[model samples]
Structures are given as structure tokens and as C-alpha cells.
Target chain A: MKPEYDLLVVGGGPGGALAARTAAEQGLSVCLVEKRPAIGVPVRCAEGVGRDLLTEFMDPDPAWISAEVERAVLVAPDGYRITLEPSMAGCEVGYVLDRKRFDRDLVMQAANAGADIQVKTRAVAPIVKNGAVAGALLEQQGSVSEVLARVVVAADGVESKFARWAGLETAVPLSEIETCVQFLMTGIEIDPGATVFYLGNEVAPEGYVWIFPKGDRTANVGIGISGKKCRSGSRPIDYLNRFIKSSFPEGRVLEWVMGGVPVCRPLERTVADGLIVVGDAARVSDPITGGGIYNAMFTGRLAGKIAAEAIGRGDVSADGLMPYDAGWRSSKLGMALERNYRVKEYFITLSDEKLNRLVHSVSQIDLAQFSVLGIITELVRQDPSLLLELRAIRKLL
Target chain B: MLLIRRDICGYCGCCVSVCPQGALELIDAYLSVGEDCTGCGICARACPLGALEVADEA
Candidate 1:
């Protein structure tokens, strides 16, 4: 029997939804399968994203934005602070999203574009025939059914098994993964127009604590620590609770969320014969920030468009899908992720004293604007020895 | 019944997502197997850390 769908997208997050919508727009028969009863619930992200990154794919929808940030407040271990006007010099602070609405709208777009969306449906395993993925065995409501497709797009977030099942090495090293946990709290005093980042090993070990305001008196406070650096046996939640008690003792408890973040380069291999992996499954999140939504949607749209084109040409093999990999790497999103990973590697090696000094120096510099290059220049000026470090790091890369 | 390997559990909560019965909860960063568990073994299969295993009930 012929395949039931031209594209079967597993996991209906930003990536899968966009992939399904894009494929359907291209006139391909698309099916989007999500394990949850709804697309976005039990929200797991910190939800801070730059406006430019978001506008690249879709317009600014008011239904999804929770708060507008004007600046980024960076705090050091010893309480030193450096505040940067994010929107100036193109380093925009952007907005924290209401992910439930944001995610649901994206999936709705896919559905409106003519993709069949199945919720509470889990893809148990990929169906392989003649050494290539043909579809998946789906389990929904205690019943199992095999859904056939010409191509499969895996966007199953951090614990994706589709890529692994398709013979790709998606295993992220402990050093490259971030164990993140967050709490949405009320009764907190926040700038409402600024996001706070607390640094220093004492605060969160190799990770950092963030306060992204949702409103005048509410925020999503969280921490993300490197898995390898979590040696104290204290969970991220414990660290967060400690930080909260000290910072916002009167804050009311609300909700708790936990998830793993892949803080590495995009997967070395995201495409296999008749299979394509996008978003978190492909490890497209930023190594330093652990932000994946924008990149997920970008890569998803690219994958869907490429899948449609490849299907039209009747070549669904690995060679045919190589363009998706090449396209992602060549995009601005891909370039930024690679650069950030290197920056993160270098930053993690600095001592707390050095970090405090670096921030202090930048705070003193009367720069009229803020940009990544501007910050790097300030760091280099504060310590000329970093030039040698940068050169060595470049050679290693 | 479900068993969790405490030493290996990073408590990332992937198993909680795949549980059809909502039988798993991460309390204080540990998997707390609840009464709703039907020994479906789905959590064990979905755990990224390989920290969960299922056994026959006595």
C-alpha cells in the first residue's frame, strides 16, 4: 500500500508544527503527531526570545507575549552589576512568551494549513523497511496503529529517540547538556521591563540563575546547570528554592517545571535515509543560552520546505535530504549557534574573580550602545591576554 | 511496579511526559512512583538517563 502521508512529523512543538504547516502549504499530505493532549502545557522553557529572531518566521502576535524587556541586567557573584540596553546596537532584550498560547497557535496554523494533527498520540517506534524509515507505530488511547509516510521529521525535543532509532548519534555529552528547572511565581517585585541574570559558581555552579519577568509582580525564575558540574548532589530545584528564599522570600509558590537542554552544536548528523531531525532533536539550541524555540521553528520550516521539494523530485534518500543540513548551517541561525558555543566554552573557564572584573570593567566603559562585538572588545581591553586565548580557541575549533 | 536508579537519575522529567497514567512525579528532584502506576513500563522506556526499570509485582 502507498504511504498515507507525504510527511509524518513527530512531536508537535514549534519545530514539528512549522514543518507540518510548511509541508501542507507546499501541497504535501502531512500528519503531525503530539504525545500530549495539547501542544503546549506544563511549559518547560524560560520563554525569553529576541524580537528579531521571532519576527524572522512569524509576526509579533500579541496573544503570545507576556512581558517586554528593555534591558539585560547581569549580576556578578559579589553583587557587581552591568546593565545593557539590549535593543540598542541590535542586542534587543525582546519578550518572554506565554508558551501555552504561542505553541497552541503554531499547531493551529499547521492544522489550518491542512495537516492532520493527532494529540495524545505517541510515536512508539519508527517503521523501517529496506534499511530506511517508512513511518511510525503510533499508540493512542491504548490502541496501536501503523502510520506510513514517505518521509519522517523528528522534532521530539531533548529526549528524542527517532534520530537514534534512525541510526544517528544524538547523544549529547554531560558537559554539553544543561539540567534546567524553573518556577512561575507571583508576589515578586521585578522591573517588568528587564531580565536579570545572576552569575558566579556559588550561585549556580557552572550554570546561572535567571529572572524573566512575566508582569509587574510575576516572573519565571529559573536556573540551568551543566550536568557534569552538578557534583554537589543538590538538584536545580533546590538551588532555585535557595535562591528564591534569599531573593524573594515573600513570593508565592506557583508551578514547577523541569527539562533537559542540549547545549551543544547542532547534531553532527540530522539527516538519514528517508528521515530528517529538526529542533531540539537535532540539538539546534544555543550552547550558552539553552534557547531552542526560534531555531527550532527556523529549522522546522526549512526541513518542511526541503522535504516537500525532495518529495516532488522523487528522491527521499539521505543524499536528497543533505540540502536541509547544508541550508541550516548556511543560515544566520546556524552561524550564531556555532559562535555562541565557542564563546560559552571560553566563558566557562574564567574564574569568578575574572568574571566580576570583566563585568566591572564593562560597566565602567561609557559605551553608547551594546552589541556582542562591543562586549567582546571590552573583555579584550580589560585583559589583553584574552587575545592569545581567543586565537588558541579558534585553532581548536 | 516501577524502580528508579537514584544515582543515575538526573531528574530531567522525560518519563513524566510519556506516562499515560500520570503515575510519575518528580518531587525534590527524585522520581516518586505513585499509586496510579500500572507497571506499564512506559516511564522506564522513556527515561533518557536509563534510571528506571519495571519488575513484576509480587
Candidate 2:
């Protein structure tokens, strides 16, 4: 779209689009590019977000929201259900979105803010000068061109090739990566106001099965297991197929999709000289639940704000961008990721029997003033050994 | 060699991120293998669609 700009954003997901919009609103030139011909077409996510989290980026528009979740039901291996009411609202009890319109809406907002937007444009390589990323070589419609900028925002989703090209080690290990598959199923009986999760090693193996209802009779039925657990006869799709047969035999499959989610720590360094990485590319998805829409928008906005400040000061070095890194790491989102990663690692080690016992114990009680400490107290009363195990992990925090 | 059945592949970028060798690329819904590939089969194992395979070059 332009020979050069103050900032060039690679990828047009929530993160990239918000970055471009925020930067452009700050009076910096911006261009956002997406490799896909259309935005959010293949809909890889479960499309669930918290009510407050969605509001942080943009007001929840009914045009994009498919469902408003009011509660969550955690199904144990033995079919014991633990229902978390609205008081436990911090989790995914919020909105199931139609990401097709949601992603496009963010890009449109960026365009309205004076940022140039281009789809079907892939950033093939980073244009490095003096060992700092200056811009990228973008290819579109079988033609290639260079777009140079003072700062480059890498929001290229899970592939993250742009960050890799800029010399960042963006590869995720099999153990940390979650191999996922989901089917949009209709004609399935589902509670229109509740999101359900089935947990246990037998169910997902280091992950869980999610049923996010889109309407009265349609839902996103999905499973995400650790990549290390994936195999020929028991891959993610295999698991999903089995679960569908058992749970929703009469359901009609409307669509099917598969992808990977990085359920690991964010990159050690999210910013380099003249470059900032955001969203799944930075591995900012929630380590326990694999949710990322909020994290992406948060980091994208922060990156834009910080990059604008850096440009104003005429400094785009890693040191200049270090505040962006430090800013997010110290934010509430960063703290939660660090905390949940440990919890995820511990949960995967729990046997199905143990999970059932724990779920049964928790379901027997009513959490009046739900809090982490209260939950820990409740858990310790049920299983004393958990206290020592939690202590071992808590010391690290 | 790493064989990619483009038909079976969903091109979700799963293999590209899991390759220990950083040898696979998902180019606009197409999987591209770079020379850096050692045929370690990590991507094959990580692919949810079972679209990738490590085999003899011949």
C-alpha cells in the first residue's frame, strides 16, 4: 500500500489490527497486512471470550456475538458436574463470537483510523538493517515488494514465521503445543446459556473438551490435547470423533477445523530492535485454557502505544522497546499466564480417579465468596497432600 | 523426505510451529518444506490432520 510507513503490521488478527489502529490514531503511519485472502474465514478458535475482556477492546455488538454465556459446567470423568455460577465470572462465562465478522470489524476499525489494510499479502522475509528489523518483503497475488518502516509488529498467529525471520526463536515444543480440532455441530441439544468443559486424562490428555454453545441447538464441540499425546489412532480429531459419537450422536456437523495452540510461556523476549511480537506469535494465549483473543488485543494496543512513544523519542532499539516488554509482563495478563502454566502442568499429571474425587468434593460445597485462596482452602481440606504440592509450586511464584 | 498431502492438510499452521528443525512453512494454506528439514517427523506427529509424513526421498 505504501513504499514505507512509521509502522508495518504483519497479520491482521485482533492484535495486528489493533496495533495499526492505535498507532494510526497516535498520528503514526501504519499498514497492516494479512496472508489470508479473507480475514477470519477458516475460524480456528473456539470463539469464546469473557464479557469484560471483550468490552475492553470494543463494546459487545450483537452482530458479532453468537451467545452470552452465564455459567460454566465442568464435567468430571465420572460424569459428576461442578457448576460455576456468575460469581465465577472471570473464566470464559461471556460471549461466543462469530469471529468472521469480529476480525473483519477490527480491521475495518483500523482502516477507519487511517491505517492502510491489505489482505492476501504475506510477509516472506524481514528486511534487516544494522542487525535490526526495519520492515518486510511482502508478497501478494504472485508479486513481491518491500515495505520499509521504523517498527514492525509481528502478529502472524501460530506459524509466527515473521518473528522467526527476524531471528526470534518462535518454535513451540510438542509438549507445550496443544493440537486441537473442533466441529460446528447443529441439531445437538445444548444449554444455550452455559459453556461446558469435560476434563480428565481419558477425555483430552493434558487438555480438555469444550462445548461452547452458539445458540439453542448449535455449539462448537472441540478438543485440545498436548501435541506429545497425538498419535496415528488417537489424534485430536480421533478424540473429537469419539466424543461426538458418545455425547451427540444425532448432531449434524456443519463445519470442521483444526489448529494448534501454544499453551506455554510467552517468548522470553517479545521485543527486539525495531520489532515487537504480539498475540499467539508471542505465545500469549492462556496456558491453561488456550484462550488468546483478549491477550492479543491487550498486547497489540500496548505495543502501539509504546511504539508511538518510542518513535516520538527517536529511539526504536530493543532498549527503547524494552518498556513494551516490561509493561505487559508486569500486567495482570502476564501474571495469570505464569500462574496458569504451572497449574496446567500439575493438572495433566492428575489421574482420572483423582480428578473425579476432587470434582466430587468441590461440587459438594458451595463457594460463597469465590476466591483462589478459598478454593485452595477447600481443596486442602479434601486432600491434605495437595497443600505440600501447591507449596512446592508456590515458592517459585 | 517430508511428504505433505495438501488435500488432507487443513493448513492451520500446526506443523510449521512444531518442527524442531524449523523446516516447514504454511504458505497460504499450502505446506512448504525447506531444505533445513531433517525429516525428523516431529511435524508429522504434531499434525492434527495426519497430513504430513516422513519418508524416503525416492
lDDT of 1 by residue, A1-397 (tens): 1238999999898999999999999999999998777789768799999988898788988889999888898898889887777535655759899999999999999999999999888887799989889899888889889998999999988767677767887666666667777889999988899999998887876778999999879999999877666533465666888899999999996877678777878888788989999998899998888889998999999999999999999998989999999999988888888888888888788779877876787665546635554566677777888888767445433
Tell me, what's the RMSD of every candidate?
5.6, 1.5
lDDT value for model 2: 0.89
Q: Best TM-score goes to which candidate?
A: 2
The positional error of residue B3 in candidate 1, measured at the CA in angstroms, is: 4.0
Q: Is the docking of candidate 2 incorrect, acceptable, medium or high quality?
A: high
Q: Please, what is the whole-model Cα lDDT of each candidate in the order they appear?
A: 0.82, 0.89
The candidate maximizing DockQ is 2
Clashes of 2: 0
After superposition, which runs of candidate 2 have C-alpha atoms over 4 Å from their true positions? A87-92, A364-377, A395-397
lDDT of 2 at A388: 77
